[model samples]
Target chain A: MKLLSNSKIWAVAVIMLSGLVYIGSCTRDNDLIVPVKLTQPFAPNRGTNIHLPGTMTVGDPTQWKMDKAHSSVLWSSNYIGTAGLLTGRFNQFGMHDVAAAEMLNYVATGQPLLDNSWAFNEANPAQTFFSGYVQINQSNTGEPGRDGGCNISGMGTTPIVAGTQNLTVTNLAKIKSTKVEFDASSNGYIVTFDLTWQGKLAAPLTKSIVGKLNYITMTTIATATPYKVFGLQLKFQFNCRDFGITSTSIADKIDIECNMNFNNK
Target chain B: MPDSFFAYAEWVELETFFAGYLLVYAIIYLVALNRPATGFVKTRLLPNLPLAYAFAGTLYLGLQLKNAYPDYTIEHLTAGVQLPYLRIWGLISILFWIPLLQKKPVFSLLHSLVFFFLLMKSLFLQLFTSSPGNDMARNNMKIYSISIFLNLGALILVTIISLLIARFNTQKRSTGI
Candidate 1:
């Protein structure tokens, strides 16, 4: 009774609560997903020097620069045993000017090559190559708590800090095209790229991802600048197990869709 | 188990747990109001349960917020520069715990002022800082409004109960009962 006086109740509560907090803090954090090696670096400010296919013949070649605001990289996966899918977007990502790289390859080898393959349909307007990275920390699903959990499970883990930009270089899902061919059977292009991500083990995991470039069009954004936009849509899927994400709620296969708009302002 | 309890439905689950906990606390406090402090367990241990629960909940919320936003700070919180998810509920959890530590009626009434400020903060941020398109903001407005009011009610109820306890003790002393 003496020790447990009314005034001493707060002290007792403090000690007990501190114990619970200490136990919780003792749990280990998940490993962080880091990129192995990137062949090309992301240059957000640089503009593409290569002309739009077929536009070179029309004498008004459009040099494209990525319009960051109009572009989005979205991901979705079906819930286990459910009809609905969980959708999210990578808030921060940038595209590599694959066209410029292609032009450089043509200059160097006197052969138009893409991802070490011959660009047979380089003149096709629908033909385009993609190279980019999605920042792991910027994965936003609108819900912050879910975003934290998803990031931990899907992209390994990242420490939550005060700033918006965190581990910008290390925590990334990088991709570069390995092969690109215009499909004569359909009004689209088939793109195969190398996806490098953090694996379940210590070493990084690199896998080939095949996707379809189903939509490519030239449009104008009716803004003050009246920007000429070259829009590209790419869709692909990869198994989450490849990255060691074992969350039961998330389906094994994740569908990724990117709507990127490049502008010539 | 902790993850399931706190991270079940994200925002919804957290708010539900808090509201439910407060309701339970109010009921238990009311039931135990007139009971004689027969022993150390009843007088000392039982009274501290609210503080223990408050600390546990606050720690959990802090960890949850930290996991969600790593770089969050008191400055960022006050600036309203970041998402409202960390701002409204995190502060509420923190402020609610402070009054639970004090036993005096006057000290507990101080929470009324804290709640008032928090209420203003919620209304200002929800109406002004959060963008209209933000779903979290819309949900926050609804959750914060109800929870803050409930907290105020609980504060008032606790104060009244404290006064009753004082009067009860005075009557017993005077009558030598």
Candidate 2:
């Protein structure tokens, strides 16, 4: 009881000390909790009619362009046990809104088209498209030290010079996808890209790592903006070997998510 | 991670969690040392210390929950902040746990603090932070947060119970009951 037998005097003193430590915090509305999904795989629903775009309906695929300022690409990966979650993003890449006639029609009609597919202009359903190339070196993992680590060791020269990190990674600089297509199995769009990882980096002991960056992201919205627009999300998974990363400390697999916003270009 | 790197470095985050847990107790024990070692010190104060730490741990965990996200940890806030001590904190805390062997009220207070510290600043921070990233996760986090607070409040009540028991013993011994 004597711990507080000095209660009155200690109360004043303890309060003073508490004040020095706590100093108090002000409640503000500044923090934004960005959402992300890990280990998410994409598989569109099936049994529905598949619409493969024709050159005429889709327009000049080679003529498409992405407005850099309007879109963003964020990626996330994991550590082995609990280095916590690791995330990085491309500061520069190519991505733009889907300008498909069906999607635009949906925006105009305020309704999605039938057969579980986007209701495009019936005459040219494949006329809608969204595509671009994602640069490698442009990936800023948020941390300079981490970015440096990835560039110097993890990614090797691909982000810098493709052949330097993994001689086999001939397309070292980017992961390019042509168009986003609706998949019946997963009820999502399937866009594919190839990542040339360091399958085998030059070494003293010969590390056996075969690397390749590959993914199919299911896009979503964080919040909605007018024109049926807002930020887009792409979530998927990959193996560490894809980047020629082979170590027990390095996890076997990692989940990735990308967030982007696009406007009509 | 590669064969050349120590895998332990990735998971055992001493800088944030382990060291943070140890510091919660060290701070309380050091504070108690400055005061007179009354009978209440062993019974009431010691247990109370850990409880206080619990409060600290929770707040810290809640605030630093952002670090669980790689984007947040690497987001250039403490540009030069690197604590080698965190790596060694686990080893140091082994010694720190020695003081906890004796103090009950102090232990409760200190133990709670460690719990809170680990949750907010250590591995638990990531679990708790990421738990709320989605609608389902957010719902689960609500239950989790409620339980954490409830447990903390329970510890506070236990400290009070210890205080009453210590007072009853003091009264009995004084009157030769």
Candidate 3:
């Protein structure tokens, strides 16, 4: 009887002890809080192209030039299509190295960008969407490298700002040899771009646009792209104005100016 | 009895069988604890707590094996594989009945051997056949560390309890009751 009783007591004691030990083991070991270190630094190698859309006026016929005093050419587009949209930008435009490097670092570490999402008003009833990019590369001379791409979606409401209306004929003729120029001044830089666009009316309309010339000017202080972790810093001001468009047409003149800051470290 | 009682009873029975297979280490520990450390063994405790250490080691091996071959038949048996080491106290309860039954040493030893062999087979199956995931392979350091700690602690506890039991048996024998 005594042996049985003693065995029960021992058994219960072991049970209680095991319970305590199991509970202790289940708790996380708080002392080991060492952070993981990166094995090696990743080199940022890719580049990207930045694009800015422009708007033109409707009527008063006259030549317009991209104002280089208050506008700087950061980047441009390439004409990929034949007719519907003759798109291309200045080839010399490219991103600084620091901004490219930093973007690569963020990608390597799997870090999320802070606030990359924005909403804007829709421009045309037929145009369902519009997106933009800020391409970065090693040199502004050779082929540009594409580093990253971001989408601008849900821009639901367009701003009620007015566009130029008195566009003349001289501005329409200068669109053929149009070139975008940037001038670095004491205060800041200015960008001036000229374009000549002409298209016939799709019938039922009398006045066909034989020549449509347009110019855009912008000005801003140079600012580097913001990267939370690492990269090259490229700074540039944001300002854009549109010229050239005649008569009442479906297309409207548009211009935008905003700062773009990025890093490549 | 209520329906819940039957359900719980069924679960307990299933648990017992699963625990029996999973925790063969507990059986080995119980048998080792019950064996007499007589003859040349002058000390009250076994010189090395081999059975307790083996129990902990096998328990850890079982857990690792489960991780490697996660899709094995036993995955559906219980949630989290029900750490076999946790069944140690249950075996300890059964050990309480052993003294009263006065089972032969040969029978107890055979029983222990069978349990040990089953534990070894389960471990081998897991190591050789299971497709261990990337996380298990990468985090081996943490897993091994926990295994070593568990085994060491279990060995110490089992040794102390075995020593106490052996000493108590010796005292009872000497009292001539």
Using lDDT as the measure, the top candidate is: 1
Per-candidate count of clashing residue pairs (backbone under 3 Å) = 8, 42, 73
> What are the TM-scores, per candidate, against the unseen true structure?
0.39, 0.29, 0.25
Candidate 3 lDDT by residue in tens digits, B1-177: 013654434323223222232122333334445666562232322333344434543553465456557565654544443434434432432332244432322222333333333333333333334333323222322332343345446646766777788889999999976
Scored against the native two-chain complex, candidate 3 gets a DockQ of: 0.04
Model 2: what TM-score? 0.29
- For lDDT, candidate 1 versus 3, the one ahead is 1
Worst 10 residues of 3 chain B by lDDT: B14-23
What is the Cα-based lDDT of residue A107 in candidate 2? Answer: 22
Q: What are the lDDT scores of the predictions, listed in order?
A: 0.53, 0.39, 0.29
Where model 2 places Cα greater than 4 Å from the true spot, the runs are A1-65, A81-83, A95-132, A158-187, A190-232, A247-250, B1-177
Categorize the docking of model 1.
incorrect
Per-candidate iRMS values, in order, are 14.4, 10.5, 11.3
* Residue B120 shift from truth in candidate 2, angstroms: 66
A141-185: candidate 1 lDDT, tens digit per residue:
898888877665556756444434332333557677777766556
- Model 1 preserves the real interface contacts to a fraction of 0.00
Comparing 2 and 3 on DockQ, the stronger one: 3
For candidate 1, give the lDDT.
0.53
Q: Per-residue error at A130 for model 2, in Å?
A: 6.3
Put down candidate 2 lDDT per residue, B125-150, tens digits, no spaces. Answer: 32334433333223223433453344
